[model samples]
Target: MKGRNSIQFRIITGLLLILLLSVGVSIYLTTANQKSNLLDASQRTLAVNNEMLNTTIRNIMLSGEAPIANRTMEDFRKITGFLEFELYRTDGSTAFNDYDTLNFVNDYQSMVMFDQTPRVEGRSIDTEDFQQVLMNKTPVISLNEDTREMEYYFPILNFAECRVCHGDDEFIRGVSHFRISLDSIYDQVRRAGVLMAVYFVSVGVILFTWILLLMHRTIIKPVLDIGETVNIAATGNLDIQVDLDRNDEVGELAGRVNHMISGLRERRDLELQNKVIETRLEENRKYLDHIKEGLLLLNSERRITGQYSVFLTKLFMREDIAGLSLADFIYPDAERFADERRDLDGFLEMLFTNKTADMDMIMSINPLNEAVLQLDQDNEIIIRADFLRIVENGEMENVMVIFENLTDIVHSRHELEEERQRRESELEQIATVLKMGPKVFEGFIEEGERAFGSLRGNLTNFSDKEFISEAFRSVHSVKGTARYLDFPGVEEHCHQLENLFAEVRDGSRKVDKSLEETVAGTLDSLDDELVLIRKLIDRFKEFSVGSESTQVSPFNVFGERINDMVKDISNELDKDVVFNLETDLESVPGLPEIQPSIFHLIRNALDHGLEDIYERLAAGKPSESQLSLRFIHEDNWLKIEVEDDGRGLDMPALEKKGVEMGLLKPGVHLPSQIVNVLFRPGFSSRDEATSISGRGVGLDAVKEDIKKMGGRINIRTSRGKGTTFVLLVPWKGDEEGVLV
Candidate 1:
């Protein structure tokens, strides 16, 4: 739409259209004229050639050389344009039929010498053009559409010279028929027409280009300039004037527009001067009176000034707030905030009396920053107080205090924190159960229940060495299993039970009611954890039963788990990562079974392979790093690759850590061998452990998992480029060419 409507487009389009039409018509007319003239000239040449044939035949016939005449006509037929040439008799019979014309001429010569009758008969002609020529006694030139040739029949009349050898019985002696093909001549005409057309089109194109340039320079550019100037003025910037200096209508329009802008500028200046003061006063009044927060100014005496926000009175639930002492206004109870009032006094003194006091330090120690005031028995609010210093002549005279009500925000934050913890606990429980597997979790749950039952049964026998030893064994075993299964809550409970039993063994605590209750409480907590596990197991069984009929794919579950893990790791590490999972897990045999190992590799990439936001940008990479996991079927192996565009392996750090861990000798080593040290247990370069990655068990476990599957893993790394870990496992395709 814009293309069709733009001035340049319209001008070029309309002008080119007109030029094309004119040029097309002129070229067409000129080409037609050229073709007509070429056809006429070609026809005249053919006629002259026909005359030459006639003159040749006549000269030979007048010399009484019949053989030469026949030979001459044969030569004429050999010419390129002549398709057919022959002589015919007056009765529409063929004349000069091969050597028969020579025979007839010899007979006439014999009759002239020995008085024999002259032969005038020849083969009879069959064509209608021959008969028409015979009857009309005129030359007939006509086009033959089927043969695409021109037929010419020129009548050869009997003359007195020919009556010397024989008597004249007919007026016409014969007709010379010439069938000439016009293909070559018409082709020449077409070529001339094409050349003329090309000439006219080239001239038209040149004229069109010149006209377009002239229009753009003289008209389009000037109009565009005027439009730009008008648009600027329309935006309320009346100070600008159009600067088109010409003696045309466009120039006149620019002058008028500039005059209008000048008048508008003057009017705007007058209006602004008249209303500036009033507008300022109205804005200030609106701000102070209607602001949501409380505003107040305090003099050195710590008294609220007369100039205060209307909200201040409403915040205190009292009128007559002006000129009130700050202490009374803020802490009306007088006894509840006694210490706060003293701190406020010192804070005010620092702001208004002290000359060299750091304002930042003063604000940091603001006593009323989070002051909770009870307006009524049922109504309480939290307000945060912020202070601004008011200086006059470089001397502090007053301080402005802004009281923002943060009651709703603080309460909402607490609620959000509680919700966040609840959801996090739920998620952690789900992850622990899923990772433990249904059968392993069931075993752990049964073991935990029996351990807790034994501890409960022996709570009264805390002093007995035999019972104490049994209880210690039970608690230790349960704790070990819980820790292995990643149930921190149950593990911690068993640890507490272990501590209580240890105290009993050392005889430092008496086996009284307090001891029994504490031990019983730990047992109860462990029992509750087992109960939650049992419920999760039941839900798992139900889901398994439902999923069989539903036919759920395990690969989708793997993908979702991987997505969640990547998101969690990204948030924990505070890194920007784009995780691209470019694989159809269901299409790769045995891939789903090794998803846990794949998850370890993914987490390692996000945690150790990819760089943080600032580190990436500093290295001239994008702030968001790229991490891709691909599973490809190559040959008879499933090739899995996990890659990252990040700060690559720190070889020196890895070598140093390997030396400290005794995984490598303190000597120069290839980076490949140094990187291989990462697959060893307890080999970590991190000084501290994070929730995402630090224990170094991920890569070690991954290597073990691949080893169990009869697969191998390889690592490729560059200094500052990135790292890719490739895993290849043997796989024979499934029956339907898909993994089950």
Candidate 2:
């Protein structure tokens, strides 16, 4: 049963089917050709017999013997395979009907002997072959399948001898019709087909048997033997070998099988030796698991080898670290560590490909050294990786990486650095507080609270120019004081608030919920700073000689404060300025409330309105630019002015900047309208901002403070002369130099 289903059996079955098909096609073609030849011979013989009958019939008609012609046609019809033999006249009428032509001739002879008119009725025949022969004057042959016969109508031409009796009006005298049976020709074809079939069957049987025997001897027997040996070898018996002994393909296949069997024996011996080596390797793996450090191997492809120390799994907090590339295992976040990953891939390529390269020099630029990795969410560790060249037979092979965990040491160093920074901050704050004194510090804290409250209030409505300016100025005032007092934390917080307002002013940032939230958050931070300063002041109070009642008056040192500020600002701006101070309201009411305005106006005049030293000389003015501050009380209004002999307002530049800042339409504007824009929030002509005046908030804040006091300012300027701001404030004072 197995041999029947084998390859040899299938191959022989397919070939046998092909052979049978070829034999069937050959028999069909030969039989058809033979039938065709037999039909041609039969047709030719029938045609020759028709010609002989025509000659015989013609001679009988010329003899004027109807009996002879009728008797001759009867004899031809009685011949085997000749069904009908008759003569047709030119008008498709038969020359004789039932021996009627003989009778008619006798009657006509009698009439002629009696000297009377002779007439005889003839039989007419209607047939396609007869009509065709009469009209065309040619022979017509047709097959009648129903009768298994062929009909031939041969035209008897009107010869010269026949034409003597017939008229010269027609070319054909009559047609000779013959109907012959085709059954005999078909019988001969059937017999010949049977003989050919027998011959083909015999040849096919002999060839099939011979080919099958040859194939079975040469291919099937040897292949079956080889298959049996292979099955035995598959069952773990490698001693079996094929015994086919020849020089053909089968013999070559058997030899290959024998060679394969020998190789299997050698493989069996090698596998036995490998089992011992595997046992030793298992022992080495157990030793590696006990090692403290993380150790792994990387092949030339940069993929981690299967064998690695067990510490890697614990260090990475995962178990599937083996067989991963160095990039995937160490720097798993591809986008975040793209540079480092590229470096690692290049380093690995160089290390594996360049065998003669310096290992130490390459190791110096290793990207993985002191690398930080996040193992899982919320768990990160720092590792210092070191690579060792793993050499095999004086050639570079795998790389051995040793990872040292440095997470704890790094965290300890960070904590120490933060501690050092905190101490330095505390020392600086102490020095600033000691220089400014507790009273001024306390006042500043109180003032910061009020400024923050105002800023927060204005944050609700940025479109109100007064509110926006108020918010801006509050922050600027706090920043200026904080800087003078060397309170860096408070100063930085104010600076951040200034930036937020500046963005809103210039139309770069919108006045939305986000802006309000950011401003509120920054103000809250400032509040926290104030709380911290309060704590520091309370501590200082505990160690001071004077108590809280020993407060200094701001009016007594007002001039000194203004002079110091001007000196500092001019030196910083690299400008030469001659400052003049005139005041008749020393004991004025609310001096401290408007102190920030004065300071802002001074800073603005020096920073924004003044040019450098070279501009003063080129403008035909004294190199020492003039700046003046005045205060006068008259008619219940205190008048104050801050003047600068520097460049006045450039209206065209201001208008252009206003359009760019989205504060004005892009067209002509009045100079007064343009000047009013100076007090609008965040409208600065300066492209970049500095610590001084580019923030576009100082004038806004100054205007906001003056508005709160029901006061107004007036500006006067010329092209190259100077610009002056005169501030008018309401004063309601009573007798005895006291407030009402």
Candidate 3:
């Protein structure tokens, strides 16, 4: 509900009220003027009639007692209003009341020679205002008391010329009174009032109609237009302008309203644009934060201007390090140190010149006394820092300083070393359980007895690979237990075992299976001999040592492995499977590692190569298939292409299934390049859960295996034809460059 504007409404209402009041005033004045005119016209006619009647009566009254003729005055009175012919005697007695039709006939109803009304019979004998008509004191006109109907009365006096009857001092006095009727005038006035009321009412109606027209144009129409504008504005439609007909106040007001609306639209647009800008700004800020690695902005003076991420703060531990020279974070006397680094410069020059050089430097980091702040739950304390700057990089302007926290690394190494030792001890304990029988070979001696006298004779030198490998699993157990039981030189014996195993495992030569078997038997006897000794070691808290070794020397090829696989794939296809084998890698260069994963992809290609066996028969083609394995090397990248004469994947059905599974849009166009989404993790279109294809880990695992080696695999399919999978890869793996 909309509330009315009290001030404006009141102003309009007040103006209407004033108009009503003005109309009322005009009607009142008009009614009054009309009433006055009616009254004046009636009064003037009455006065003229009175004067004519009085002149006629005076002639008769002064005619010396001549009989008063009523003819002339009767006519005058009828023409005006009412006339009464009531004569008064000279002695004030009633002579005659001749006009019987007059209701104003007074106490003197007698007909006589004298009458009165409006100064009739102008004899000074007996007038209402004449004092000389008195017999002795000269009486004046006699008073006539008729009903007050605007009547005029006068007295007729006897004249001295002839007094027909006796009269005092030859003066006969009488009176006549005439009356005028105003009923007609009052009727006219009432008729005028009714007409005036009608006129005023009609005028008021006309005024009201005019006001409605004006308001419709000025107020109502404009308000309707504004309402329409408001509706459009609400709907976010900013195109329309209110069209108006006039340039009055309402028009001006509408113009202002339109202007205000335009301003609001502009503001809304501005705010929306600002919101988009703000969102992009926040997004850019996050992106900047993502890649801003250990960056420190510096001014022209090489002073730290600013730093933005947690990495910098962790490295420096000094938020207040700003405004400081860049070299302040370096080793003490960095200025002098930098100057003396010309040797590093010379080595760098040698690097560019391809000349070998080994430049090493030692530097220390001074720690601020402030305690290290710990925030991440998985953080360790940092106490000191030292850097081993080795100049090997030739392109950079700055020294390639490699800072290492040797203390932390060394501590970690110790902990890991302890864990390894404990694991070895546990394995040794398990071996003891496996050799629990005390009656060993029916010729066992004392628990402290060696396999032969002085067991260390054959393993004197631990550095030899074959002897060490055999000694660790065999004699190492005997030695650890012997030490636990206090056998002489037992600790030295176990250390020799550790050194021996390290050499053998890390050696270049491979140990034969026969040697391994031979060592296993010796290990069993040694574990049994040391079983009781291990119990003693547990009581004394002693453990055997552990070590790690790795060797990546080339191993012998399984010789006929590639030929065997090719024969197998071709045999399965039941056709001559061609091998466009790159001669350089006819035998897989890194066959030992790749053979495990490669066989799966190769087998899958052959098994599913049946391209509508019947259709092939009809097309005069062999039911069997042809498969080709092509391998090439270019620019450190190995490209292997696997092709087969087999039915391609049912792409339409696959896409439909993908849609039905709600993983893809109904009309999405699957890319033909990688049409085989079957390579995706856990993907299989084979309907059956269990198949000779192996349960789980199909092409998915193949893809994963390739990916784990930082390689990529892609498949291209052609319907009714065959599919080809291309595997591009790196022969060298991460094992070389791995930080660990």
Weakest 10 consecutive residues, lDDT, candidate 1? 114-123
Candidate that scores best on TM-score: 2
1-740 per-residue lDDT for model 2 (tens digits):
46788777787787789778887888889878987787777678778888887888778767665556766677878988888776777777777543554466667657546222222245577887788777787888787656778888898888888776566777887788878889977777778778878888889888888888888888887788898999999999998888778998888898999999999999999899999989987997997799988999898778998778888779988677777998988888899989988998998887778778788988888887878888878999999888887888987788998999999999998889867765676676676556445766787888899988877777778766666666777779888767655566788888888787667765789888998899899989889888978998888878876643453344444555577668878998999988888876656676656677777788888988888899888887778878998878889887878999889888888998888877888888988888888887777778787777788887877887899899998888776777898888887574212110
Model 3 residue 423 distance off true place after TM-score fit, in angstroms: 90
Per-residue CA lDDT of candidate 1, range 64-83, in tens? 66656766777777988877
List, residue by residue over 1-740, the lDDT tens digit for candidate 3: 23365434554676578767876787678767886676566556555655566556666645522233455554555664564444555555444333432223321223542443222342222443322333433322222224324544444555554354334564445555555555665666668777877787787778766776786766876877787887887787876677875688878877887887898889989999999988886775465356423444444344454343434455545465566654454322456657424433433344334324333322211231122323245654433322222233543222222223244666787789867875666555444323322112111224234533333354344356444433333333333233322232343444433443443454633455544444444444445545545554443333322211221222112222334555654654454555433335533444333433455566566555444456667766677556666667667776777777677778777776656644566676747523545654333455433222422234655665577678888777777677788877786622321100
In candidate 1, the residue pairs with backbone N, CA or C atoms under 3 Å apart (3 or more residues apart, or in different chains) clash, namely 92-125, 93-124, 93-125, 94-123
All candidates: TM-score? 0.35, 0.54, 0.27
The predictions' CA RMSDs to the true structure, in order, are: 29.8, 11.3, 34.6
Assess each prediction's global lDDT (C-alpha) against the native: 0.74, 0.78, 0.49
Using TM-score as the measure, name the better of candidate 1 and candidate 2.
Answer: 2
Off by over 4 Å in 1: 1-533, 537-548, 584-593, 634-636, 730-740
lDDT of 3: 0.49
TM-score of 2: 0.54
Kindly report which residue pairs in candidate 2 clash with one another: none
Q: Could you tell me which 10 consecutive residues in candidate 2 have the lowest summed lDDT?
A: 112-121
Clashes of 1: 4
User: How much lDDT does candidate 1 score?
Assistant: 0.74
